[model samples]
Target: MFTAVFNSFESGMIYAIMALGVYLTFRILDFPDLTVEGSFVTGASVAAIMIVNGYSPIIATLAALGAGFLAGILTGLLHTKGKVNPLLSGILVMIALYSINLRIMGTSNIPLLSQKTLLTNIQDAWAKTGIDDVLNGLLTAIGLGDSLPKTWSILLMMLVITVLIQVGMSVFLKTEIGLAIRATGDNEAMVKSFSAHTGNMKVLGLAISNALVAFSGALIAQYNGFSDIGMGIGMIVIGLASVIIGEAIFGAKTIVRATLAVIGGSLIYHFVVTLALRVDFLQTGDVKLITALIVIGALLLPLITEGRKVKARKKKRLMELQFDHKSLEEGK
Candidate 1:
C-alpha cells in the first residue's frame, strides 16, 4: 500500500507539469486550447523516435519540446491569423498531429524498455554515489529505516524538477511579457489599448504552455518505458481536473499559490484514482470513465458549495427580516 501510494504521488508530480501548462492557457490566457492532446503525443512520439535512433535522451526531450512549441504556434496562427474559431483551430491541429505523430514514430507504438532514460540515468548515478546508503542510515537513525522507499532517488529527482519548474513559472509570470500575457487573457482590449500585441501574446503563451506539456509527455514516455499513439487521449480533462482541484482546495489569489495548488491537486487526483482502481468491479478499461467522473465531480464541487452558501445567506436574511417585523409590531 505504501509503495502504491508513493507511486501515485510520483505520477502526479510528473503530470503536474502538464497541468501547469493547461492552467496557463485555460486560466491565464483564457484560451480553450484543445491542441494539448496532440501536442502531448507529439512530444512523446518525437522523444521516443529520437531515443530509439541513438540520440541522447536530453536531446530527444528538447526536440519534443520544440515540436510541441511549433504545434502550438500553428494552432495560434489558425486562430489569430487564419480567423478560425479558437476551438476549431485546436481541433484542426489535434487532427493533424494524429498523423504527424504516427509519421514520427513510423508505428502506432514504440517500446523503450532497453533504452537509457533520464530517470534511469539519474537513478544509476544516485546508486553509484552511495546516496541511498546515507539516506538509509539517516532513516535508521530516526527509527524509520523500514519506511524508506526503494525509488526514493527517482522521487527526489522528480520533486526537484517539479519545484524548479514551478519556481521558473512563478518568476516568469511576474516578468513584463508574462504580465502582458496575463493581461491579454483578462482583458484583451485593455492590453491592446496599452499598445501590446494581443496576437503575439497569445502565440507566445501557447508556445510556452505546449512546451511544458510536451516536456511532461517526454518524461512520461520514458518513465512508462513506452509511448503509445493513444496515450494522449483525454489529457485535457485530466489537466483541467488537476487545475480546478488545486484552485478549489488552495484558492488561487496569487500565482505562487495557484501553482502550488496545481501540484497538490495533482497528488490528490492521482491518489483518488489509484484508490478507486483497487475496487473489485473497476477494471483497467474503466480508467477513462473513472477519470471523466472524477473531473465532473471536481468541476461541480464548487458550484454545489456556492449554492449551499447562497441558501444559507438567504435563510439568514429571512430570519433577520422576520425579527425586524416582530420588533415593529411590538413597538407599535
Candidate 2:
C-alpha cells in the first residue's frame, strides 16, 4: 500500500505538469487547445527517439518542448490569422501532428528501457555522490527502506521540479506580459482597446502551454521507459479532470492558489485511481471508466451541494415570512 501511494505521487507530479498546461489554456487563456492530445506524444516520441540515438536527455527533452511549441503556434496562427474556428484549428493541428510524431519516431513505439534517461542519470548521480546510501539508511530507520520502491528517489526529485514549475508559473502570470495574456482571455476587445495585440498574446500563450505539455510528456516517457503512438489519447480529458478537481477542492481565487490547486488535484486524482484499482471486482480496463465516473462526480458534486443549500435557504426565508404574517394576524 505504501509503495502504491509512493508511485502514485511520483507519477502524479509528471501528470501535473501537463495539467498545468491545460489550466493555462482552459482557465487563463480561455482557449480550448486540443493540440494537447498530439503534443503529448510529440514530446514523448521526440525525447525517446533522441535518447535512443545517443543524444543527451536534456537536449532531447528540450527538443520535445520546441516541437510542441511549433505545434501550438500552428494552431494559434490558424485561428488568429487564417480566421479558422478555434476548435477546428486545434483539431487540424492535432491531426497533422499524428503523422509528424510518427515521422520523428520512425515507428509506432520507441523503447527506452535500455537507454540512459534523465531519471537514470539522476539516480546515478545520487549513487556516485553517496546520497543514496544516506537516504536509504534514514528510510530504514523509519521501517520504509525495505518496503519502498527502488525508484523512491524519483518522488523527491519530481516534487522539487514540480514546485519550481508551479512557482515560475505563478510569477509569470503576475508579469506584464502574463497580465496581457490573461487580459486577452478575459476580454479580447478590451485588451485591443488598450493597444495590446491580442493575437500575439494568444499565440504566445498557446506556445507556452503546449511547451509545458510536451515537457511533461518527455518526463513521462523517461519514467515509463517507453513511448507509444497512442500514449496521448484521452490525455486532454485527464488534464481537464485534474484542473476541475483541483479548482473545485482547493479553491482557485488567485493565480498562486490556482497553480497549487492543480498540483494537488493531480496527486489526488492518482491516489484515488490507485485506491480504486485495488478493488477485487475491478479490472485494468476499467481505468477509463473510473476516470469518467470520477470526473462526473467531481463536476456534479459542487452543483448538487449548492442546490441543496439554496433550497434550505429558501425554506428558511419562507418560514420567517410565514411566522411574521401569523403574528400580524394575531395582533389584528
Candidate 3:
C-alpha cells in the first residue's frame, strides 16, 4: 500500500507541472487553450530527440519549452492577429502540432530506458559510493525514516521545482505586466480602455502557459523513460480535473495555497485512479472512462452546489410568501 501511494505521488509530481500550466491559461488568462494535448507530446518528443542526440537533460528540457512556446505563439497569433475565435485557434495549432510532434520523434515513440536520465544518473552516482545508504543510516539514527525516505533525491528535486514555480508565479502575478495580463482575462474592454494591449497580453500569457506545460512534459518523458505520441490524449481533461479537485478539496483562496492545491490535487487524482484500478467490483478495463468520470464529477460539483443554493433560495422565498399570505388573511 505504501509503495502504491508513493508511486502515485511520483506520477503526481510530473502532472503537477502540467496542472500549474493549466492554472495559468484557465485561471489567470481565462483562455480554454486546448493546445495542451499537442504541446505535451511536442515537449516529450523534443526532449526525447535531444536526449538521444547526447544533449544535456536540462538543456533538452529547455528546448522542449521553446517548442511549446512557439506552438502557443502560433495559436495566439491566430486569435489575436487573424481575429480567429480563440477556441478554433487553439484547435488549429493543436492539429498542426500533432504532425510537428511526429516529425520530431521521427516515429510514434522514443524510449529512454537505456539512456541516462537526469534523476537516474544522479541516483546511480549516489548509489555507486553507498552515499545514499549512509544518508539513510543517518536518517534512521535520527528516528526520521518514515518521514524522510531513502529515495529522497528525486523527491527533493521535484519539490524544489514545484516550490520555485509556485513562488515565481506568485511574484510574477504581482508585476505590472502580469497585472495587465490578468486584467485582460478579467475585462478585455476595461484593459483596452486603460491603453493596455489585451491582445499582446493574451499571447504572452498563452506562451508562458505552454512553456511550463512543455517543460513538464520533458521531465515526464525522462522520468517515465519513454515518449509516446498517444500519451497526451485526454490531457486537458485531466488537467481540468486536477484543477477542479484541488479547488474543491482545498479552496483556492490564496495564491500559495492554490498552487499547492494543484500539486496536491494531482497526487490525489493519481491516488484515486490507482485506487479505482485496484477495486475488484468495478470490473473496468478502460482507464479513459475513469478520466471521463473524474472530469464529469469535477465539472458538475460547482453546478451541484449552485443548484442547492438556488433551491434553498426558492424555499426561503416561498416561506416569506406564505407568511405574507397568512398575515393578509389575518387582517381580513
Best by lDDT: 2
Q: Model 3 — which ten-residue stretch has the worst lDDT?
A: 147-156
Model 2 clash pairs are: none
TM-score to true structure, per model: 0.89, 0.90, 0.85
- The regions of model 2 sitting more than 4 angstroms off are 129-146, 305-332
Write down the RMSD of all candidates, one decimal each: 3.2, 3.2, 5.0
lDDT of 2 by residue, 124-225 (tens): 876667666776788889988667467556888889988999999999999999999999999999989999999999999999899999999999999999
> What lDDT is reached at residue 227 by model 3?
96
Candidate 2: lDDT of 257? 96
Model 1: worst 10 consecutive residues (lDDT sum): 144-153
Model 2: which ten-residue window has the lowest total lDDT? Answer: 145-154
Most accurate candidate by TM-score? 2
| Candidate 1 vs. true structure, TM-score | 0.89
lDDT of residue 272 for candidate 3: 86
Tens digits of per-residue lDDT, candidate 3, 170-193, equal 788879998998889989999999
